[model samples]
Target: MENQNLNKILSGEKLSIDEEMVPGTIHLVDLEGTLNVKKESGSQSNIILQPQPSSNPNDPLRWPKRKKLAQFSLLWFWAFMQAVAVNWSGPIWTLWTETFDCTYMQLNISSAICFIFLGIGCVFLQPTAMKMGRRFVYLGCTIIAIVSNIIGSQGNSVQVLYVVNLLSGFAAAPVDSLVEISTTDVFYQHERASYLAWFILALYAGSDLGPVACGYIVETLSWRWCYYIQIIIFGVLLIVQLFYMEDTTFERIDRDDLEDKIIQQMKSRETILSAVQSGQLSQERVNSDEKLNAIVSVNNSINTDDDDESVDSSIPMRTYWQKMRLVETEYNDSRSWLTIFYRPFFLISFPAVIWGGVVYGSQMMWLSLLATTQSEIYSLPPYNFTTPQVGLTNFGALIGSLFGMAYGGPFVDWITIKLSKRNNGILEPEFRLWTMIVPTIFNAAGLLAYGLGAAYEAHWFVSAGIGQWLLGFAMSSSGAICLTYSVDSYPKLASEGLVLMLFIRNCIGCGFTFAIQPWLTRNGLKVTTWLMFMLSIIINGSFVVLIKWGKDFRRATKNNYYKYSDPMFGELFKK
Candidate 1:
């Protein structure tokens, strides 16, 4: 029976399923631009749809395409800075250790703390964005970043550096979650994956560019130039935000349509008053007249023209300074404020959520290794490299990352569309996991090559060079795909999900950093790297485990966040 169903699905017949097994078909895309929603829902187009955009012109969903471009341009610039700040210390750890008389462990801990705080800060910042508004979070965080950098630039002690790191992490945390949330708020489902890939690129690109710039800065200038440069970047960002970032949260209750009804009521009340006074109407209607009078008195402030019910765009656009409000509505939902701190921990049960954390976190280990090990490898025998030369080595990883950024989105989207077509237009979240197969093979191959080459004392071009680039390509592509899949599968709770992913990713990264020196010293470079490579294979391969069990996990966790507590697994609880 299952075989027959598969054959029918392949032949383009609608794949049938039990309705109670899933929620509404809002996310299922069996065909491009068409969803396989039940005909009983009364969709005129015979398709299920979502993100059912509001008619409000002020709605971010309905904003002019030109405005969308302008808004995103500003957002990307700001987000790139946050990304750059997080990894600034990685390449400069050698300088930091010498300057502070601290050990490598202490320096690594300081860097990892910044990453950890990013997740910690997001837990509060995201819920605040949903409650108070994203505009305030974005602008406020940028301002904080500027102040943190200035203080960091002037700091003379190691303790001051630690405080600077903490403040930087806290201020930049909102960009990690809220920027992605803003993307979803503005774009449609079809465009989400591609746009998210762009976001990931801007974010991770910092990990690369920071090293490159810091390498040059530390060699030619003072170590403090790193902080100085960031201060300038963020200072400009703060000023631009004042003029460019508009409050996108909207409440479009159309009071203009209420104007006509209010006018007629007022006219009726005047007639009633006249009739009663002239003795043509009974005093019994006096009670009704009084009610009518009250209604008119309340609605007298409404302005209307003809029967135009559209929201008022007639008012002049707010001035640049006037548009700086973080949240325009007086509306408040207290529960939203709590989500930032609470939801990430609760979502640990979902397979999709686990994959997001594991895949992203594991791949980040390799990147962190590159940052942690670059100076040691290049500065020692076989290659006596200067600080600038050490920084240039990151170019290998950067080049590989550029490949992932350029091709990862299109590859994921193409495969998803193709898989959905073959499965009778049913677009399962699991379909995206297939993109991992290619990148996984590359990851294992690259790790083996790097380990073996390093162990055998092979040419730097082979082990440290090509191997690093391949690992980078694999990590960048896999991280992008995994994150996109998580968002695609469980977007209703993506804000919380992102924070959790960040925590898991940074912990794993920090874990790898701590283990790198110990493993190398005890087992030698080749053996330790090979062991890590083997472990990475297992982690990357776990995607299959998720694909098999993910649906059940989603059902268990599905819509649960909406109620703060809810049922799952469709009919499992029925007795």
Candidate 2:
């Protein structure tokens, strides 16, 4: 009976059964055929078929609007918690120094390790997610992070702290990459910049909010509570995810089975037609068979054609694992990860990434320096606050992040959309870039104010306000533009491009934090910050060059970019 049903289905005979009963099975049948089958109980079922391989409305893209938004929100919250966990320890650096018997530099090393491992983990986790699928990778990484947090909280040694920080960073990598991919998966191309802007805003908000929350906690309770707090948060997020997050990977509809069914149906139709013409088949039988065959053939053709058209019309799909294989091949031939590392180097080596890096790095460096400098410079007897209070200077960054999130992100997207429409539906990635001009000018002015304020011992609020407003807007605009531009310009290699930007940006930030303090102390805040302000003007000003010549740059580098695409961008660029 099973064999007969299979033969009939293959021959494009329509079978009557609940469609849900054949879940995960691919049926290929002619669009114009009648399917008849007898059950074990001698019950006959007949289906007047249309075609095989019909479009299933069960795809993630076809999900209900509310359900889709809920998915995005859940992923956003997941990313936020991961960001908070990594940076929560940042504000409590002083406590760690005292408890672990380490210097400020040593504590910085631990924080740096978290970021460094984040980059390193992306190399592995991204490919793993591509291979194993998003849901599994995300769930697995969250579990690893939970365990890492538990182990980190119980650690007594500095060595253990460093190891756990690195492990936790490794575990956290999937959250960012997966969330970005998932957001891209659900949103349309036109809507991506805004969605991504929000995602980044959430990310920065978590980073900024972490210190304030952790500062209050460490001040009143033990430093261990910071980790404990994250553990609880992670637990709650994990539970929410288990109940809410749906799998979003693209499931390919099988074409081979459908093709075979169509072939069989065509043969069955010819047999029935010949029998009818020769008068071996009755008119009733002939009519029924002809009607069924027509229905099945049309159905099969439409299904097959739809599947073929979809594959032809859209970008080729390759899992990250498959791209990694190509990368490995290239690596074996070239004996280098140059293809991976050099992707962002072109952009990084560009004056824009560097200048952006300097302005951004300087902000971070000066903020750290000013925080610590407060106690020494002020010298108020009672208000001689400890390192944590100095760390409270991070609140400036928090304030800036909020301003950026609230104003900068949406402004960039709105302006870009308007400009894109003005260009007759052509959206240059550079459209989103023009919004950076005001922020750039403001950032330089902010630095200048911070410098004068700090050097002359002006009101603390003066330095904080200038720094916060400038840094907030600068971080918001630069981060939004750089990321959006890279994704738009190199949508295929967006992940790699971002990784490159992150590498150079953070390297500058970390390097300058060490150098900026000593340099400012020796040269005076006025000279140091003025120099930084001048440098920012130089760096931020280069956006004009990028906005004008970016397409030219892309054209010049197209060959290399195309070669890199095979390994870096996967099948997306093949379009």
Candidate 3:
């Protein structure tokens, strides 16, 4: 049976519930209620649990809802604080020019350095997190953030500022990549988009609203106080994490064959029950019972030792201190450090994943554009806005992002289910691509309004209010939708896929930041904005192509996916 299943997959067959596995493919919706896989146990019971939970009490998927939320809340707050540190310097760029006697270009270079380190950090830190466990990395990054902020508070030169951003960027790397993976660690597939939306919200809130508070701090206190406050907040966070943050890293054995057996047994049991109810019990019914027992026996024979231990009630659950331990070695991926470090690079061949990176990276381009120009544009002749006023402009993006979060998170999840039902109860990763249409339109329109309004010297609302709000919506929505799509497509590689996505995203951000001043000087606002608008459309509109051919891409890569998934297939180079 297993050999036949493998044959079907190699032959490019459409995926079915009982068929061989494809990395990005799964049976998500069951409208007829025929498949006997584990389902969500409520009104929405048709939703199948993707990467179904194991029988082990210690599995992160089986954790209590409140426990999951508590851990998520800590990571969420950590991301928010780290983002605030990365962005707080933006509002004070003008003040820093005088204090450090630096050029605006030099300050932009500092921002570019931060972006460089952010991408580099994802590549270097992910393997460590995969090995030492998520808790160890989170706590370690918090400590590094505290010390970096302390150094930043004492900065007296442009060079010192560069060093501070470098460290801060590395410390905050997990915010972009690891948070999503950690969120997936506990949440079911059906619940992920909504929570991942929350992660985006926390990220944007910090980048946008952090400037608001920083503007006020620079007005009343000094720029140094910005870092001082972060130092205090991070101190508190580290304490809370030490006591409460349990590691979510867990190793799960493949249970697909066992699940297939269970599904078959369920069908046979139903047949026997119906025969008995109709008073038609016969040799066939007895044979069905015998077949069920044989299926159970086959399943038991193949169960790994770890599976047997999971069902052993004699073993106690982990103790509180054990759960709170800073490092977890038991659940390590067992690959050499270099293997995990280089894995994301191999995913560059994955079409859907590369598209996801481009979609997400575009948001960072707009974000970098805003950061590079927000102070420069608003502080000029017509507006003559103060630092605090420049900071307040981000409020429009903040409000827009909140609306975007709702649409991208829960709304996307809801739409996916509806579309799956319409497709005869089979969910395709392409369903989420439909959400991109709204963002693509908004993104283009926002760039036009923002650039042209400034060129024509129209009302501030034309650019900052209407334009920024739209950009905020695009940034938030496109980010969540694309990320959810990539993970849904290749869940087995969620961690590695996200790392490459962020690496692409931050590299785009860095390159754009370095070029923003030169690009603006060379072309001026109107021409630059038009060019950007065209670029945004081209990159974001690729969703249409993906929607048309995404499944084919996943199909083409089945052999590659399986090869990389195997622990021993490439051990020669992995060592």
Best by lDDT: 3
Question: Could you give candidate 2's per-residue lDDT for residues 412-485 as a string of tens digits?
Answer: 66675566545543356667668778767877877776667766767766765666567666665566666666
Query: Candidate 1: where is the Cα deviation over 4 Å?
Result: 1-18, 21-49, 250-322, 327-336, 556-575
Pairs that collide in candidate 1 are 30-425, 30-426, 123-340
Estimate the TM-score of every prediction: 0.77, 0.66, 0.89
Give me the overall lDDT of model 3.
0.82
Query: Local error of candidate 3 at 284, Å?
Result: 6.3
Question: What's the best-to-worst order under lDDT?
Answer: 3, 1, 2
Model 1 RMSD in Å is 14.2
- Cα lDDT of candidate 1 equals 0.66
Report the Cα lDDT for residue 446, model 3.
92
Model 3 ranges with Cα > 4 A deviation: 1-22, 255-312, 572-575
Q: Tell me the deviation in Å of residue 71 in model 1.
A: 2.0
Cα lDDT of model 1 by residue, 37-150, tens digit:
221122222222234344444456656668877998888878888878877666666767778787777666666677667767777787677677778888888887888888
Candidate with better TM-score, 1 vs 2: 1
TM-score of 1: 0.77
Scored by lDDT, model 2 comes in at 0.57
Give me the candidate number with maximum TM-score: 3
